[model samples]
Target: MNPDKTLAMVPADTLVVLDFETTGLSPNMGDRAIEIGAVKLERGQVIDRFSQLMNPGFRVSRFIEDYTGISNAMLAEAPSCAEVMSQFAQFIDGCNLVAHNASFDKRFLDAELDYIGSGYSGEFVCSLLVARRLYPEAPSHKLGELVAYKNLTHDGVFHRALADSEMTAQLWLAMLADTQKPQLSFAQIHKLSKTPKAKVPLYLSTL
Candidate 1:
């Protein structure tokens, strides 16, 4: 139950890069997710993908609209997080989840899973952490900034679920190269997440 193992290191196979666009910042404050995107990797290759827009049962902010390009009208036709999380949980089953700022996405996801009478406690790898550990000399650690620093391009427009997920995937590949560690298996990661911690750092997502 060593907290250091949460993401201390990993092997390079069966990773799932995930991203979420939520109605607002605080999941506990009623900010629910409106979109989700995920890409599954096996042995350094992307083998499966998942993307869906969700109805958060609320309105998206003007700022959010401008940022993510996901409108209320677009969400009206989408499924609820409860509906999609079920499938998403399955999609990411037995894989380590990777995200740029993971805590943000994880909090919203954990709350949604709770609401659905389920639990989503899994091992997660933070790209921001990798950035901190590997590129401590970098001026910025924001995903877009990191992408630019790495000289990578976002194939799809930014902010959308699938596009963001794809960017996360590429970012993960770059991180793998930077960290020089193989991807970890689900068993190894889950044990790390479940272990108790004395002082959990303010996760990258919150920053």
Candidate 2:
């Protein structure tokens, strides 16, 4: 998984949507990612998504197996993190990331890249923050719950990166429509990336 190999597959400046299924939470606590998915968006549309299962170089926990339905046997034949992350980073070059919980995905991704001798300081937008602000009336902000509430059944295979990324992209588009503000500018979103100084009023949703 060389840089040149990745560049040859995807072009620059594409909007890369990302998702991950991990062995556990907190990269700082030794949790490693087991799957990665990235979707390229160009011209405000999804062009393609890259996804692969990864061997996290550790045993899968019983909790992880119960939650994601991915076990050690499933990852025995999967690629390594460096291998899949290389391809993911290639597709994501020069593109802003969109994800449900941006920090969780970004932290692990950054850790993996850093571990592989790559540095990352990319821009990102979080749909979870957006949901907390825009859909205050909804009780749950989790992606799966949102999918069910929105009735957007599209054969999503959870614990797989690509499928989750695709679903997140669709959910974001739907949210834009719901808010009647489809043309939000880059500057506006950049502001969203900032940590708000004061606690703002958030709406309460009925779950």
Candidate 3:
């Protein structure tokens, strides 16, 4: 659970796959997350869900509103970011986290959690990075693209937190299923993902 330690394999039972819909690209620029959605998966099945819209203490631009379908009016009625993150911290307790393009989510997650004086112990896995290694032949690695390439079901929506998180969860599972190495530990798979793609087969053969 050390933050500095990368996980070795996909969690076998419980983990959380999450997504955030934000006002802009960088939390460092003061853009805040407008909505957060996550699915708790246990043994490849969704066991619980958490979704919330948070007021960012500022109005979002029309471009953001349009892109995310989350208007300023909708955020006006939502709880403050602190309140939502406080509960989110609880929701993710003792669970590893997975996110597509996890660096982006990790930045926002750490920022929001730091602001609330809270934190989680679980390490985060980047499904994006994993997919790049696992599916090098795929034309595109975007969440939606991977979903279709893997033939995962979706509700035909993107950019929203919950829907995107659901797609990410499916993509994560599909990638794991494709690994063909059920005996590999989570740490071993994590190590395999970080290995150069050309060397993956060599590493796996040794495993």
TM-score of each: 0.80, 0.81, 0.93
Q: List the residue pairs that clash in candidate 1.
A: 11-182, 11-183, 11-184, 12-182, 12-183
TM-score of candidate 3 on Cα atoms, chains taken together: 0.93
Q: Which stretches of candidate 2 lie over 4 Å from their true place?
A: 1-14, 190-207
Q: Is candidate 1 or candidate 3 better by lDDT?
A: 3
- Which tens-of-lDDT digit does each residue in 165-188 have in candidate 1? 788778767765654334444443
For model 3, residues 1-207, the per-residue Cα lDDT tens digits are: 644354334453358999999988899999888999999998789999999999999999999999999999999999999999999999998778889999999999998999999998777778898898889999999999999999999999999999999999988878877777656555665576589989877887787
Per-residue lDDT of 1-207 in model 2, one digit per residue for the tens?
Answer: 754334333322246778989988899999999988877777457787787889988889998988888889999999888888787777776566778899999889899898788754446778787666666677798998787777776696776777888888777767655644345443344343353423322211110
Q: List the residue pairs that clash in candidate 2.
A: 137-205, 138-205, 139-207
Task: Give, for candidate 1, the lowest lDDT window spanning 10 residues.
Answer: 198-207
Candidate numbers sorted by lDDT from highest down = 3, 1, 2
Candidate with better TM-score, 2 vs 3: 3
- RMSD over all Cα atoms, model 3: 2.2
Q: Using alpha carbons, what is the TM-score of model 2?
A: 0.81
What lDDT does each candidate get? Answer: 0.72, 0.72, 0.86
Give candidate 3's total backbone clashes: 5
Task: Select the stronger candidate by lDDT from 2 and 3.
Answer: 3
Q: lDDT of model 1 at residue 59?
A: 85
Cand. 3 Cα-lDDT: 0.86
